[model samples]
Target: MGFLGSVCRCSGALLAIPIAVIVAVMVETPTVTKLEGGPTFEAPADEVPQDATEASKEGPAAPRMGSGSMFDRIAFVYDSTNKWMSLGLDQHWRSTLVKDCLQLQPEDKVLDLATGTADVSILVGQQLRTLGAATDSVLGVDPSSEMLRRGVAKVESSGLDHVVRLVKGDAQDLTSVQGIDAAGTVADPSAGAATGSIDKISMSFGIRNVPDRPKALAEMRRVMRKKDSSRVCILELSLPSGETFLSKVARGFITHVVPLIGWVATMGSGGDEYDYLERSILRFPKPMEFAAELGRAGLPVETITSFAYGAVNLYMAKPEFIGASRTLAALQSLVRQRSVELLTLAMLREKVGKRVDAADVDFSAFGCLHFWIEDRGFGSEVNNLVSAAIACEEFGLHCVVEDEVWNSGRLHTYLQAEPLILRRCPDEGTSRHRPLEVRRDRRVATPGWFAVCKHAKGVSFAKKSKFMRRVWRYTTETRKRIDRLNEELRLPPKYIALQVRRGDKVAGNRKESVQITGMDFAREAQKHLSSSCSVVVVCTDDLTAAEEVGRALRSLGSPAEVRWRSRAEVPANLRNGHWQASYNSLTAKQRIEMTHEFLADVEVLRCAEVCLCTFSSNVGRLVALLRDQRTVSLDITEWTND
Candidate 1:
């Protein structure tokens, strides 16, 4: 009988014997012939000879024999055999392995190890092409020359020979094949510098065939870049073991049906090889255990996903450096301290080798905007900050709010924290560096000129309403507090929101502060309170004004309930000096609480049926910017009924 015919014919007899005995017999069998009177070995014409047994006796650290030679005998029918054995699910699985597991990027340089017939390499090339990355290349390496020869033909036939190259190489010894450089040009692999130059490395259904799996894994890690940008993926068949029906069904098919299909496909030439496949699947480690093995190989597994009832698993990992933990901790610390400017300067120095002239750098390419905040009250500063952010976005720059602005009451709560790049002066001891020019001769010149100048102050609010609306999102804690307050107050369904600016505005400039009075607010509230059910919601910095507005509304015979925050509810720290002074003096925790309260008040105003307030109030302008509801803003002089 032929080699595969004997294997199929003996399958029944082998099943009658204990599995342990069968495994021992298979291991002891001489699959290759040793040359007479020499250490050299020989196998079939297509089979690659390995001296693993001879090498083992020379020292205690001998290399393990792999199943590459076994695959060499079945290379011609490997792809067809897999299709039949997998019942046509192989292609679907491979596509998922490429599209999802590998996640090929447009510029990625991929390395496919044990690329039996370059199926994975072709899929990768196709994915890259779909992503409009025709310049990207895939290098496929396999230990079996016959497999590579077949793969080369497939590459040519698919018209991907330009980007997909197949070579005769071992997974454990990847130093032989040329690798792509940073400029995407092929570099000499023999120079040993190509290691860690690859953007991604993938092994599909091939990790199982390697003899020294850990060493092969380490070589894969060595070929991937050390940064998180580089990823390694492994897709391998797994043995199902659970008591579920699917697991039992898969187990039976892998042990019996898979070998039977292989026997028929190769015309009984690959039954023994398929039998080895069944054994290997059963011997392979579990997903978690294999992930641990990958970790030991210097590729810390990032994600592991199983497919088809755990019969197949995909492992995605990145090269782990020894100091990565420390580096991450330090980076987090720097972020908390808002030292992004210093960090950015350090990175700039590293890239340029030395400090370059600020004029030489094109700041626009960095996608960031930097500007100093004027030392002013919270409300004025916020108006400048928000306008600056809006101007930055309009000019195609991402606004990076200063740490001082981030610590303010409402501004900190509303704006996101992004890093800003500060230019360094050539003179190390110089106190001042060149600031980004927002204006030229007191006129707005740049797109983000509004951030530094007063031009187009409300342009963002008018033109970019959608952008302004999304600029602030209440925190989960603040939202919950607002919801609780809303429930407690049981606010009227139809009410008018009234804002009286008194505290700081009256103290600093009575012209701006006393523009509107309690009687003026009561008269405006009456317009909305046409029915007894209507109510008036009052928000003000002055407790006295809030109380006087409630009395004036009642005296006007308006049945609408007058609701306002009582003085007792206001924190004592927030009641002193101008509202800005009180706000600036509060502790961080107290500031957060005050910010939340302010946001809640704004929320009420935003949801009101109609809003009436003085034009000079920042809260009134902010509310008008956020909501489309009817808003009536009277001048400070009009409030005096003059």
Candidate 2:
């Protein structure tokens, strides 16, 4: 009538002898056998050779029956036994874990522990392939050689040998394995020794078998890339606890029918192993209790999903590390909680360090010059901020822009490092902690409020060079993305960079002073289009202007090719006076993409032999500052004059 009753009736003593003998014969058969004349069968990496030709030539040897816990004794029948017992739902469950739960990315590296027959590992490779990731990204590790041997055969049969790998590994002691160091860092020749490299870890019906789950979990956390991005998924059998009828049926199947079927499948030699599974299921902690254990093991449990009326549970977690991002988020929370007055006082104390003479002390706060560009564009804002930082260096005050600004602006995005800010303050929150003051002129100065003053004149060339050097050194991620873009573009060896300023510059107020046309930019570019120039790169906010310059140059019969972001590539929001509005309206991801485009354009301009542009554009100024190439400013008057 029910599932367990049917299994019990079918698995009686009558069929045991023949099934046992078949399983015995299967277990005794060597996965790899010596050939008569063909090349010797050598295991590739941790693979067990399973050539069909070798199997036909050799007779069944001896069954590897050892201890009660030995998996090699049942490796040949493991998948079939489980499939029969679970009614062919084991594969579906594993696939659900990979597709629904893991959601792996293209660049992710997976670690599948207790990878019995590499079923879960192969599934992970399949899922990654769907995400446009390479198949060779998954590494399946297990302790049983026989299991890995069968896994190798399945991998070869499926044509997934290039994508997935099987390795002999103990989950509790993964540090001993090659490519995985004592530090738990995964090293691969293709991916390199990426710190905290492993992206997702999946253990299916495996954690219950591991003697040291806590250590195994710690190992998972150690190899994971980022606490915020990486996940650990554990799927295991559990005893049904609910009072529902289905729960009772599931319980009966696990407690009685599973062991009986396993016993018949192994032909009594390995039947006791099935009994251990039932006992282990009953011994495993409840979902909540297991979640607590996961937390104790240094992983923050995210979700626990139960299937088959609570007979199986999948536990998901991520590493819980107090990284720099978390610290900054906490600091931001603290800033939001406290009043501005208290924050100012805390910052003042942090800046002064020692007691200050209140009378003669100039109360000045160093920060990004956000208030300097009330009527100016983005470039003016950045130029002022850079000047302010230089002035802060000259005046011996710590630049506080790093602490206060949270916007996705040029200064915050481009600068490699930020000035240190005061992390803590006194608990009293009163003037009693303040230094004594003598009578004198007192004023609280905001760094951003002060225009680039006479003090900025003292900023030496060496200091400017040091600041620019640090600011220009891009982060590793940014550099990689830019390099990929460069490869995709395939620019010629020699090129002339042109920065054409139009849009908001020639529209609205002071249009007369900033008036410039596409022909104007084209004429300026023509001056540098010599026989040696291999290409022309035009960076412009206005798509029409860029196209006009391209046509003008083409009509002149210039030998060099013109390269620029196609009109389709540039988002419509970034064109004309709507650039700022569109930028503000963009989602976080879109904003990041826009920023990358801007930075990439700057990098392209930096690589040019000669730069031609109006000084009014910040792109031109930044390009001139970064390179020693001859720059011709089309605008004769100073663009900084307001």
Model 1 ranges with Cα > 4 A deviation: 1-65, 134-136, 178-193, 322-642
Off by over 4 Å in 2: 1-69, 178-195, 323-642
Which pairs of residues collide in model 2?
Answer: 135-163, 136-163
Please give, for residues 1-642, the per-residue lDDT of candidate 2 as tens digits.
699887887777659854553354233221111101111111122122121111122224311111113676788689999987776667877887898678788988888988878899889887776787875698887767677777877777777777777766666656644333222344442332234878888999987766555556667877788746788888888886644445566788889989999999989977767886777677676554466566545565656666766677777777666542244445656665334324443543443322221113232432212222221234545444555556555554444332222234434444464552111122112333221111100112222232343333345544554565555677677887667655555677678887777654465222323656666767777777777776788777677667877888777766667777653445786764324534645675665666666677777888888877667666666566667567777885332321
Residue 370 Cα positional deviation in candidate 1, in Å, after optimal superposition: 52
* Estimated TM-score for each candidate: 0.40, 0.39
Top lDDT model: 1
Residues 178-240 of candidate 1: C-alpha lDDT, one tens digit per residue: 443212244455533177678888888988777767668768877887666788888888886
- In terms of lDDT, the poorest run of 10 residues in model 1 is 33-42
How far residue 601's Cα lies from its native spot in candidate 2, in Å, is 78
TM-score of 1: 0.40
